[model samples]
Target: MANIRFHPNHDLLSHYACGELESASSIMISAHLDLCPHCRQKLASIEAEQASELEKSEPAALSPSLNAMMMEIMAQDCVDIPVLDEAPASQLALEDKAYPLPSILQRHNDKIGPWSRLPGNIKRAQVDVSGDSQMNFIYMDSDSALPEHTHQGQEITLVLAGEFYDENGTYQPGDFIVQTEKHKHLPRTRDGQDCLCLTLLNAPLHFTSGLATLLNPFSQLFFRR
Candidate 1:
């Protein structure tokens, strides 16, 4: 992902490395780690540091009886390790179009719901990642746009395929974007480009400007499946 312009911050990555994030958020970061070499390297460094600290910590001495018990267990015949069955690659299909999912998402294939229509030219497939937040696969058709909106809480979007642009800049595959209440922008693709994104929203989006404002009342559609 050479074109990736956005990424999870160090604090978020640190939390992910520490296994301190919620399951849904952890999956999001794990998928991003698959796409991002830089973040992967950073996470590796963080893990190494944590491992070093653990190694440096003093361990209590074991009693002779406990040590003898451990030795007796180790002396027993070892059982064979079971080989895991390899699963076929997973793909997300919409009509005739299909997109390969990241490894982390592939593991959750059963959790993905069917695609449903949304306002504008957008379509959404809810991902049943259990948490207080909502996760979805948001598909934007070519030349289509979502109305300008700001977040009620926090919103995170990771580009899975194609490209999209906002008032700020264009986002390519592997780009990790975060939005707060202070930001308001329309997200859309160019004439020949459609986009598939994985989005995690902690709260409903507040549609801004014109007729889109009326949509604010129904914003729960984005929050709920």
Candidate 2:
């Protein structure tokens, strides 16, 4: 059993299985599922429940126009759409090291931007997903710390490698943490332990500490394209 301390709630998992979650949130959930067997089993259960419910529901009658359009489309030449292989021989690189990405993100490997250094001993690479939200791969070097901050809207962070600690507790790989304006904390790694995380932010972070407050103006740089 994987010791995953954090996980997406049942509602979020249901939404993810049903394809109802936003793109950014869906990516986070997918990454977490890659590392969490518990969540994988939970998701399978949810999917089975959904299938049972769908089986019990009565089918609705299609409109005459919709039925005619569907018939016309079906009568036309059957075109075989080529299916692209989802597995790619690619890796997410940090410095000289390369890490295998989650299966869901493999297709978007090209959309990841080059890494840029941050004020702290952190490096960030943005993922270009079609949505209002922002997704990033945040790499924290050993003994590094992010400025104390809170989210303006919502922030989801999933540990990809190593471990990090905030005032709340320590987070290992597969931990799915959600934060909003109501939560504030500083994330850091100890000596000899580096950390990498996939983060999705709906809004810019609000730095609240003394010197870190000065970084509020530059917070947009973290999320902006």
Candidate 3:
């Protein structure tokens, strides 16, 4: 009963479960999975199918010489391998309120930069991911609105708290929205309804209207790492 109205397609979920998606996209999908039980169940079914297929396609047996070599390798003296300790989970705090992050993002607490104000009534915190893509936590204050914009590449937004609406539809918590160059809309929150979202953008946003188009040059400063 998450009331989730949006989700990644089956192909995307399959790619995620098979470890075929890039790091940034995988992180977005993982975070979405944290909030969506439906996707979790679908992922489990995909994994089971993959396991069954693996079993069916498994090679028959190792060659005798290869088995002997493997045995010898296993019989060799064991070297001490140091295992790194897991990082402690951390909360995302804003305006004196702390929010629990998705499990996949827990370790990245240290990577999250301090919040910074953006144009409009929005605030953003960049997440240090190791890739060309950029990830951010975008918080919109109550009754705030972002200028109409489109994407140059692709963008994925996951609503973590509150709600936001655009030409497409209203998105509640646990909603997974994907937009590309073909989409354009103005996103906003209603009175008393602020919103927080985790977003992954492969390219800077393209401001598509009136005075907001003047912000195109500055868009790189906000979105590009």
Candidate 4:
């Protein structure tokens, strides 16, 4: 069981209704919605809205050379590529835990694994990496400040450290937070054990400053998750 953090100013459940949730957001909402059926129906109503929107999108018209060119491109496809030691099907099934980010991340932040030193007081190690999603564990030194940044989608930050606060509130060990597009915060950890967190995000931080925006193009190619 996880402690619930509610926001009075923001109706976070509204994000669920807007279909703006990432994987982490979906899981959090699922558990909470299960406990509250009114929100569950709200989710259903949201789904219906998405369906209607999808039905109304204009389809793109393909160029006259599209089919023939696609056939030519496919005909030249190279074969005989083999991968070694793929992850087991069980691991890919995502049945391991309901709190996958928290469980996997907290266990490994105690010691380093692969992800290395990044700027600021943050050190990250990627644990679960697949095609569309990435799971990283972060450790922030006390008195460290991670610069203000926005995210490509949603992120689940599970505090495994002493305590950290942004414009929001302090997060301590066992505190799980879902950060969506609507939420942008600068975090800091001070006066205690190093703040460690499990951050599962769909994409990398999109720096939101004028100077940062100029550097965004490079970041997408290299710093992308």
Candidate 5:
């Protein structure tokens, strides 16, 4: 069975499935499900349970006049809010850039959300998912090795594109790696397109890479944020 591994990102999954997540988050998860069957099954189960509950406890019928009034209101409320400004147009193009990794490998980021690019190596960026700091999205350069880091809470990493090898196994697109609070892993991606992933970073990531972390305990600061 698809158990809740990594962070309990089920709420984020639920939000994405129910059309509550931003476009970027939804697209990233959709790509992940294309790879990992276990998470897909879990999401299916949750959806089924929610559907059953709604069917069992839905509200009673509304009057015909009430329906008519609702319809009228909807018709009157039809309006197109602003979407792409000049800055967002460039941002959109950036997401659509399909960087080639190796051996004909290709990956692209296409999601509609309030996404802000983060600084990193070439072809790497991060998307913001939650305002409440529950979920996070991190993008990687193909074949790049992420720095070894530890987490305070559970850490869930779902591969959206490309492949990476770690202590567990070779995680391709859609495969999820669950990490506990006490676990530490170093992941190295194989040659190909860079892997895109959605990370439910519930806690701060403690940097354990190189000699820097040994010298400074507070070098990593996102958790403190």
Candidate 6:
């Protein structure tokens, strides 16, 4: 089980409950919800609240004929509903290591692209979700580091397995972290520990500091498909 620390903001959760987020963002949140019991409870609360509001909006009494039909249906004997077998959980393989995909990703497994090497011991596999944003699975090898950078737009990352740390703090599984243009930091893994994360970026990353600045061109590798 993950020791979840970060979570999507309440506004995001509200939008998710209402089915308002874009496809890529929705998948990110759904994956986080799978790993987070807190968010699950919050979502249930939001759903219940929405249901109540819907009742308030249409405060109409059911007609006698409709009420009778409902009563008759309720009185009918219950029939056994066939239960479909659940698909086996999907696994993402990286050499000798395999990580179980979240439930949401399993449904869209075919959309995941091949993993490609990235600079600084990172590997990325694009997820072909709809909308303008880009989604990818990022794997960081042990003791690996990505150069310091700031977001060109918004970047949302959810730790799927293991952990990584930045100047701000350590992120464990189920951490839903968001960084905007104003935030800048270097992300790396510790000596023995590695990390697997699902990340969504609205724009390419802007490399900052040292020789890494030359890597600005490399950002396109992550941005364009």
| C-alpha lDDT values of all predictions | 0.89, 0.88, 0.90, 0.58, 0.56, 0.91
> How far in Å is the alpha carbon of 45 misplaced in model 6?
0.5
lDDT of 5 by residue, 138-182 (tens): 566666676676676666677655666777667665565667778
Cα deviation at 191, candidate 5, in Å, is: 5.2
- For residues 14-98, what per-residue lDDT tens digits would candidate 6 score against the true structure? 9999999998899999999999999999999999999999767642577888868866886899999999998999999888989
Lowest lDDT block of 10, candidate 1: 54-63
Global lDDT of model 5: 0.56
Query: In model 5, how large is the Cα lDDT of residue 38?
Result: 74
TM-scores for every predicted model: 0.88, 0.86, 0.86, 0.51, 0.53, 0.89
The C-alpha stretches of model 6 lying farther than 4 A from their native spots are 60-81, 217-222
Off by over 4 Å in 5: 1-31, 34-45, 57-124, 134-143, 191-194, 212-216, 219-225
Between candidates 2 and 6, name the one with more favorable TM-score. 6
Clashing pairs in 3: none
2 or 3, greater by TM-score: 3
lDDT of 2 by residue, 104-133 (tens): 888779899999988689999999988889
Instruction: Assess the local accuracy of residue 81 in candidate 3 as a C-alpha lDDT between 0 and 100.
Output: 98
Cα lDDT tens digits, model 1, 143-224, are: 9999888999999999999999999999999999999999999998999999999999999999887688997888787477
Q: In lDDT terms, how accurate is model 2?
A: 0.88
Which candidate do you rate higher for lDDT, 3 or 4? Answer: 3
lDDT of 1 at 214: 91
Tens-digit lDDT string for candidate 4 (23-100): 555544553443344555666776787778855662234465785675577579698988896333221111232223
Q: Which stretches of candidate 3 lie over 4 Å from their true place?
A: 60-89
How high a TM-score does candidate 6 get?
0.89
Which residue pairs in candidate 2 have backbone atoms (N, alpha carbon, C) closer than 3 angstroms, thus clashing?
none
- lDDT winner among the candidates? 6
